[model samples]
Target: MKRLSTLLLTASITASVMATGCIQPTGDAVSDAIPTAQDVRVNLPDSAGEAPAALGEVSEYYAMTRGITRGFNAGAGFVLVLVHAIVQMPPTTVDGNTYTWGPGSDPLDPADYRLTVIDNLDGTYDWSLDGKSKFDPNAEFLTAVSGLAVAGDEAHRGSGEFTLNFTNMKALDPIEHNDDGDGTITVIYDLENRDGTAASLEMHIDGTDENGQAVVADYAYAENQDGSGDFQFSLPADVDENGSALEDIILRSRWMADGSGRGDARISGGDAGDEVVEASQCWSTSFRTVYETSTHPEILPEAGDVSECAFADQDLPELPGV
Candidate 1:
C-alpha cells in the first residue's frame, strides 16, 4: 500500500488527469473547484448539463476495495495485501517530549476491543497492528491498519506484497466479533481533521488464519504498472541545497492514469530534490474516535458495532489533469 501510495504520489508529476476525486492543478488552468465525495454523488448531475444518473450513494460505489482473494492473491504473480483499517491507537506529547509506541500499542489488559486479520485461505495474515499512544496517558490519539488484498488485471495479473506504515497518530482500538468467528472483523476505522478531510480504508484478501503460516508473494514496488508514470502520492522531509525543515506532503504525479490512480496530497519542490512534507489537507476519509472509549468496547467487528460510528459526509477531491 505504501509503495502503491508512493507511486500514486509520484504519478502526479508525469501527466495530469482528472480522476473522480483528489486533484491538484498547477497554473491559471487550475480551477478553484476541488473535487469532493459530495460533488460526485450530489453535484455531478446538475453540473454535467444532463440529469444525473441515480448513483447509489457516495460511500456505496466510492468504497475502496482492499481485498485480493479473487485475482492476484492466488498464484505466483502477486500477493497484494489491501489494508483498510483505521489507526485507533492514540499518541501523546508529555512535557514537550513526543513518546512514540516503540514497537506498538501496549495492552491495558482486559482489552475490550479485539482485532483479528484473516485471509481467503481461511487464516490470519500474520501481521501485527496497534496504536502508539504512550506519551500522553490521559489524552489519547491513535492510528491503525488492517487486512489488505489486491489482484492484477488479466494481462499483467500477478501477486505483490506490501507493508503499511501509519505515521503521526495515536492508539489502535482492536475489533472483536460475536461469540462465533462470523462476527470477527479486522478493522473498520475512520479519521479526519477539523475541516472534514480524512482517510478511509476498506480491505479484502484470501489466505490463512494463523500468523506466518501463509505463502504470500511479495512484489517489488513498481511505478505505473503500464509505464514509468505510475508513482502516485508521497510525503517526505526536505533536503534542499542548503536544507530546511520538513514541509507538507506535496501532490506530485500526474492525475491521468496509465494505471496511475488519483491520490490526495503532494510534496512541494519534488523536482527540487530531497524535499518533502505532509500535505496540509485532511487526506484521511475515516472518522474520528478514540478506539478504546469509542461506542463499542475496545474493538468490535464492523462500524455498526460502535454505537456512535459516524462517518463524516465530506466531498471527494477532483483530479484536474486526469
Candidate 2:
C-alpha cells in the first residue's frame, strides 16, 4: 500500500512535467488528450493507523480482508505506473487528431514500444500501447493495452473504460516484466456525479491466476465525502484437499473514517452442498473482532455481541454478481 501511494505521487509529478514541457498552444492540449491517473485509478479506504492498546486480540479475518484490498490496489497501480511513464512523454509525431509516441520519446521504454492516442472528435479519446511480437518474428507490433475515455464535466474529465491485455503483453514480455496473470483486466470509473460528488469505480478481471487456474472476479468501490468507503468483490472458486471444487464466495465490507468496519459474506454452490451459508463480522478501530455470526454454525459460529458493530448487515451494498 505504501508503494502504491508512492507510485501515485510519481505519476502526478510525471503528468505535471509532461503537461508543462510538451503541450503546446495547439487546439489539443495534452491535458485534454489523455486521462489523468486519478481519473482511472482505484481508490480504497485507508486502514487504521495503529491498533488500540485496549484490544488484546486481533481479528485474522479482518487482516485477510485488508490484505486483499492492498493486493487489488497494487495490481492496478502497476499498470497505471507503466502507462503514465510511456504516455506522458513528448510525442514523436501527431497526425490529424492522433498522437504517436515512439521508443525514443521515453528513454526507459523499449526500442519497439509505441503509444498512440486518438481524439475521436466526439468528446471521447482512444489509446493503445503496442510492442514488438515475441511469437511471430515477422510481426511488427501487437497491442498490449487499449482504452477509451469520455470527456465529462470539469469535475470529471476522464470517465470511461480501459483494458489491460496481459495475455498479449506477456507474449512479448515475460510475465515477470508485464503482469503476474494472463488475460484482461478491464476498469470502468466515474470520478464524480452530476452534482460533483464522489461516484464509483469498478474492475472486472477475466484471467488466469499465477498458478494457471481460471479466475473471474468483479470488484466495486464507492467513496463517501467523509472519508468512509465501501468495497465488494467475489472470491474465485478453489479446490479442497480432496480435489473437489469449493463454493462461490462474495464479500462486502464497509469502513468508517475511524477504521471500524463490518463485512458480510455469502457462500453457496459446490462444496457448500445444498445449503447457502451467510456470515457477518465486525471489527473495532484496533481491528479486533467485536461480533460475528453465521447461519451455518458448522461453518462459522456466533461470537461476541452484535451491539458492538459500527454498521448493521443492511448497511452493506448488494454483493456484485450475486
Q: 177 in model 2: Cα distance from truth in Å?
A: 5.5
Tens-place lDDT digits, model 2, residues 273-310: 78777878788877778887778765567888788887
The regions of model 1 sitting more than 4 angstroms off are: 1-145, 148-225, 249-251, 254-322
TM-score of each model, paired residue for residue: 0.20, 0.78
Q: Residue 176 of model 1: what lDDT?
A: 20
lDDT of 1 by residue, 180-284 (tens): 111112222121212333222222222332332332221111222222221122224342323555432323222112111222333344333353222211111
**Candidate with best TM-score:** 2
State the TM-score for model 2.
0.78
Give the true-structure RMSD of model 1: 25.9
Top lDDT prediction, candidate number: 2
